[model samples]
Target chain A: MKQILAVDDSMSMRMLLRASLTAAGFKVEEAEDGRAALEWLDNNSPTLVITDINMPRLDGFGLIAELRARDRFRDIPVLVLTTESSPEKKARAREAGATGWIVKPFDPEKLAAAVRRVTH
Target chain B: MLSALATEPRTRRHTIMQGESEVSSDQRMVLSTVLGSCIACCLFDPTLALGGMNHFLLPTPPEGRGEDRGEAERYGIYAMEVLVNAMLTRGASRATMRAHLYGGANLHEGMRAIGSKNAQFARDFLAADRIQLVREDTGGVLARRLELQPASGRVRCRHVAEHVPDGRPAAPPPSSGHVELF
Candidate 1:
């Protein structure tokens, strides 16, 4: 089973990601916020990570930076799912080593394509 | 400035009309808003006109409940569920209810995290709860002043800012001759 870590501040968002990924044939895990996501990463290394930008404690930028700076997680694919369409945030995310970016309210079809594109 | 104001017809009595008592054979709700950093989402059941809204600030609620049955407190999960459940209690079915969402604004600077989280939060909640989002207008560079008409399931979101998302200071276009049937 290709393990996928879905992280977001909203349980609702995580629910959608889990259902969509599970229906697509991948094992899914959930994280309520960015800090929790990093903690989850410590224990289990998933093939792909899908995260939202705004969170309670540690935001997505912090999570992505932490992941990118580490050699073990450097190769893992990270995708940002957010409502921030601003170019400033997008540029910062790209520089932080994100593999892809998808706007909010994403469909299953779009998610599948992103996963395919990022995951080897 | 006072000379010009004195010439106008001083309208003393502002029109104040109350709405219908929320009644839904199925699930319907009523809600309130608070806090500048937070965005309120009023999810209504189109069939029943019964739903509720929550003012969510950060993405997740303070930890302790641990996704157990007590998760009804998490902003993203709990708040949305509470609104949905409020409608379901009024005899509305979740499957048939069409979600009408409102409120996603950038009220503060570093608060970009909150704005993004709230927008994604609402969208994901509806998707997870198996509810269909009939209409959505979110993530602008302004705060929202909204009112939910339970009778019609119409959520009017007014961008309350001197500027729009495009960096232009403009009032929102008038709401007329437009409908999103999805």
Candidate 2:
């Protein structure tokens, strides 16, 4: 099974995402915020990282920058799942090395397709 | 309904759901709810002392889920329309309407940004209907608890913390299953 790291501050959202991703056959690991996601990254190598933009402490952009700075995680695909839709925000994510962006309230199939697009 | 009505002697508090809306001419009637990614639009007419509120989870329902599913209320179009119609029925003139929008938080990371979409939909919906948007607090990471006084058109917003402090027991999750309020 492919391992994927899911990061979000909302427990309900995490539960929904986990249910969707697990149903799609991906093994999912969850972190509540960017800082916790970094902690998880220290011990685990996920095939892909799905992250939300706005978070306490470290945010999605900060996480992407931190990951890109490290050689081990440099090439790993990072997809931003956030409620932000401004063109400037999307540009910033791309500049920070995000592989793709998906707006929130995603269904199972849309999420699975995005994962497949980035990982495969 | 009785509890909300009983409290009406002083102040009436109404907690509405995703597809639900309420309109009132009473200054003591306060409408409130906690939102994750959904959008709540509050409409009020100063001249008529009429106010209304609606909460919507999505901009539009899924393609195949038709009106018979009773899911239309979950979409912005239906929610906004219902609110406007209710206000009109209560003697609010559309020409004097003003709007205040809240919610649309990106509470969950690594998922579609439904909150932003909902907020955008609200702005467009209001604009298309020519309702002046007087106030807005939307698009953030924190979930919010919002209260609106329809008659006075006053609003209060409080940010909800995402996690309980270390060693503290978390609040019990809301019960699953449909709860019908009569």
Candidate 3:
């Protein structure tokens, strides 16, 4: 099964994403923030990374930048799952090397489709 | 879920709907609401121990929208006014009142973040009314379940995830004419 790392500050959001991704047949891992996500990356490599932008310690942009600067994770796809829809934020995420962006209250099917687009 | 009530059996609970406001001096009454891309303002008078809350879907309704008084409550202006007036009527003094804000989650991506806009409007409205905003938890991608105890002016906010059931394709985004309330 494909492995995916999901990161968000909210527990409910993490639970919801886990449920959706697991139901779609992907093995999912969880992290609470960008810092924790980095720690997870230290020992494990997943097929793709899904993250939220606003967080307490470190953020999605920082995580993407960190991943891009590292040789081992440079080409890995990172999708931003957030509530931010501003054009400025989107452009910033793109410049930081995000693979895709999905807004909050996302449909499970659309999330799966986006995941498939980036991972496969 | 009235889990809070289970712990405190004496607490009275009430759910405030969209475009609605409730005020009371009853120490046992708890007003609650769930928000997604919406805003809820809780106002309280420290001196009088009277408080109220309002849930609004938008900052303003469209031009030439329905003139019914009920329709007006959906806008921030009316919602704030109604909440304040209700509190005042219940012996809350404006000079001694403060506000707390919650909700305003951006539930959808691609579309404009109406939640942010609503949060801004709420701040502006409170400032314009000269009400001090004591606390705020707003503007994110997750939904919130909020409970406000009017008399004690205590509030609890819990983040909740949005669930999209399997086999149910997401519904198409709605147009301005079809604004749905939560």
Q: Estimate each model's TM-score.
A: 0.46, 0.51, 0.51
lDDT of 1 by residue, A1-120 (tens): 888999875566677678778977889999977889888888898999988776657878889999998888997999887645566777888889888777543546557767866775
Model 1: colliding residue pairs: B26-B91, B26-B92, B27-B87, B27-B92, B28-B50, B28-B51, B28-B87, B29-B50, B29-B51
Q: What is the C-alpha lDDT of each candidate?
A: 0.58, 0.73, 0.75
In angstroms and one decimal each, the interface RMSD of every candidate reads 14.3, 16.4, 14.4
Model 3 chain B scores worst on lDDT over the 10 consecutive residues at B173-182
Runs of candidate 2 with Cα error greater than 4 angstroms are A1-120, B1-9, B163-182
Tens-digit lDDT track of model 2 for B66-142: 22234555667656766765675566655688888888888778634888999998898787666788888898887
Best to worst by lDDT, what's the order?
Answer: 3, 2, 1
Fnat of candidates, each listed: 0.06, 0.00, 0.00
Q: Candidate 3's residue-wise lDDT over A1-120, tens digit each?
A: 999999976555576689779988899999988999999999999999998887647889999999999999999989987655566877898999998877554556667877887788
Cα lDDT of model 1 by residue, B41-129, tens digit: 55555555454445544455445332222222334443454455446546566577776555566666876666667778777777766
Error of 3 at B166 (Å): 21
Report the lDDT of model 2 for residue B30. Answer: 89
The true-versus-predicted C-alpha distance at residue B133 of model 3, in Å, is: 0.2
Go through the candidates in order and give the C-alpha RMSD of each one to the true structure.
18.6, 18.0, 17.4
